[model samples]
Target: MSDNSSLLRVSNASLLPPLVDWTPPTFTPAAQARVAATMVLFVFAAISNLALLISVSRGRGRRLASHLRPLILSLASADLMMTFVVMPLDMVWNVTVQWYAGDGLCKLLCFLKLFAMQTSAFILVVISLDRHHAILRPLDSLNAHRRNRRMLLTAWILSALIASPQLFIFRTVKAESEDFTQCVTHGSFHERWQETAYNMFHFVTLYVIPLLVMSCCYTCILIEINRQLHKSQEGESLRRSGTDMIPKARMKTLKMTVIIVMSFVVCWTPYYLLGIWYWFQPDMVKVTPEYIHHLLFVFGNLNTCCDPVIYGLFTPSFRADLARCCRCRPPADSPRSLDRLSARHESDPPKAT
Candidate 1:
């Protein structure tokens, strides 16, 4: 009987306490390692994004740079906000394992984090569609400066509006253990129902719809690329020529779009899938010890880091502006200039048919 009682105590030690009785454990060595890594990445991302923003913003008056200025600024600003503002508070929460900050701060952090995340996602979708329009319909008015600005403004306003529900749903809750406090959504059944509804709305509207739109845009873009390639090949074959040189500028754009899409898929898909899974299996799945929760939180923050890198990769105007701002000479040659040369080639008369 003594041995059996000892065994039962061992089993209880291995088991997690009930939710109502739970307190967040002190940060372990491994947790500290993870938080440190996250903060390092956040700082690096913030600096790079800020540099990119300063570069692009300085080029606002240049005619060639004007086209991408808004895009560069918007993405950089979002990333800066996410990395500097959102991630620091999150790190504090991770370190202390409690909401040492007041209720007001809890609400603000919750709102800012959700708002920035949604804004980043929406901006990515917009950038993808913008690229699709530029490539597939180069002559279209959708690329106009005034229209782009208005669209960007609209995107910002819409992202903020979408994030407003978080303010109402999240609150600083005094844990039942009475020894700790944490930020969580808490309310009666009606309030919980409202939270659930908002969660569903966010999942569907922000992630699902935008994902579908991006997918469709990329599909159309691929189809258009194929069509253009075929036409270019046919033209070459008739002239006994090999290939038309695809402008480096256009290639850069294509590469940028691909990177952006891939990054979005990599950083956010896990979070979205986990969110849905958690929402559905709130009781069946245990997130503690497994550390899936921490993993999701870290990756979700990485989207901010990835955004500016994508911008720098795809946009030559941005790169040029960045170099100029850094007091460095721009690359002597670029795809945009090659594009101009190609356009001039098109205007030249063909040999007698």
Candidate 2:
């Protein structure tokens, strides 16, 4: 009787099928909209960034870039990298509806995403510092361009280092009891604070510190410009001899600085704020965050679109070059402004020791 019972139990167990938390594999309209929106954003970002790169890299645009070669190149490169390296991975994730690339690629994707963003932030900070140097401390310090290039290289290396931790802590796991995989930070419960800690760290590093640095630099730049303009105005001969052009140039640069910083804050603040809120109140997960997430990401990438416009706004030389590229004839009557801009670019790159 014992042997028969054991056989029956074994047969009954064998008759049961394996368990799988499967859901209907139908594509929802919501998912389709998300993918479509993301695709459009990616295409726009890629084109805008590529145009900025081309403008700064070749032909007449190259003349304008020569004055600030390292920063211009670094800025364009950072944005271009996002459109290439990061956007494609994001698009794939949206379309697949699963993290099917396994753990290794998931970590890599997380790393690259963080690296691109952090590097871009770092580049913005450096650009502000470069502008400060060019304006307030106008003398060349031997190999200034070479030093700026080194700074750009260092910023990239540091960004990678900063993002490296994500690879170890983030992983691919099945969502709850679902059949699909999720790439997310591994959970812990020492104080149930892992998510908050990571989110805070990222927010502070990528957003807060860079913003502070840029803010301080631009403030000082404005003060210096005001003082210099006051002194130049006190001299009547300086105005007649076109020496006032220095102050005008400084004012133009300050305008661009203000616009870029404001645009950066606008584009990035919502995303980081939402991330912090989610991490701090994990119980609020029931709240509909999909639309919020989509909106923030789309705006975050709008910065890439805005950079080219910022360049053209403050730099007439760049406007002329951009016009050439677009095959839009610049005003036949605006030759004087364009010539002055060209003259400024050539004379501006080098300074007496």
Candidate 3:
């Protein structure tokens, strides 16, 4: 989310056992700005992610490659989780400036927040890997469905497992002296380094590892593409086919996904970098303008809003679906008629390419 927990730590230093003596953070202008920006992003993300999921499951999406459909569907599903879980949680937490939901919800919401974020990153990695396979090993496309399924299953399970520690680490700690309560990992660790270590672990897993994997996958894809281009240049027949090594559909998909990954990196890198700095040097928080962190967080949330836009830009089917929805236009033919037409078309003689 917006790292409310980190903000809580900033306000309350020297964590003690049951009750940490500290002042509660107020809903300052910075927090207000974050909440406002988050509300805008949330509305866009909710509508767009839902539209993408629907488009992927029905109509033209049904005609998408069997292997690719799952990847896109999984990506949209993860973005939806971020939409519903992280956006609302960050907005509400910023507004209230304290935990009113008590301990049970405190733990559960924290877990869900991490789970959503981790799931989103993991799914992107899966998509990158899928693109790699599609480009590098075209013949293995037959087994792609099975391979993608296994990878998706692993991504989900790994996300849950990585985020499981949140349940034990977070709780509602009341600052009796200030007569305020906040949900944080204040008393979870015995030493300061332990808390830093925990945060760094999540930071690496959530950002660093996924970024590296996506970069490597794309790099290899680019090198392979260049090699194919060179080979095509050497052969007159290859020139006639126009880089037939990679199919147009597959290349288009790869470009769309690369942009998506770029969006992720561009949006989240600043927020995470600030977080890393604060984790290592808590003193920096005092000198840093509070609005900087809040702005960075809003920038990070932009990634959720970007995915569907990128997909629509690449896929004509998605744009057509949106246009159809806006115009309230129904298909000229019913589903049964469409099916019969499709069958009749299939029975006709093949046309020359």
Candidate that would win on lDDT: 3
Give the better candidate number (1 or 2) by TM-score: 2
Better of 2 and 3 by lDDT: 3
The 10-residue segment of model 1 with minimum total lDDT is 1-10
By how many angstroms RMSD does model 2 differ from the true structure? 10.3
- Looking at model 1, residue 183 earns an lDDT score of 61
Off by over 4 Å in 2: 1-31, 65-67, 141-143, 188-191, 232-251, 315-353
lDDT (tens digit, per residue) of candidate 3 on 105-218: 999999999999999999999999988887777667778889999999999999999999999988787776787887777777778788888888999889999999999999
Candidate 1 residue pairs in clash (backbone atoms < 3 Å): 249-335
Positional deviation of residue 68's Cα in model 1 after best superposition, in angstroms: 1.9
Put the candidates in TM-score order, highest first.
Answer: 3, 2, 1
lDDT of 2 at 182: 54
Candidate 2's TM-score reads 0.80
Question: Could you tell me every candidate's TM-score relative to the true structure?
Answer: 0.78, 0.80, 0.89
Task: Give the alpha carbon lDDT tens digit for every residue of 197-303 in model 1.
Answer: 55678887667888888889888877876775776677743433222333344445556766876877887777677666545455424433435656665776777
In candidate 1, stretches whose alpha carbon ends up further than 4 angstroms from where it belongs are 1-20, 59-65, 188-194, 236-248, 284-288, 314-353
The global Cα lDDT (0 to 1) of model 1 is 0.61
The C-alpha lDDT values of all candidates are 0.61, 0.63, 0.79
Model 1: residue 312 alpha-carbon error in angstroms = 3.5
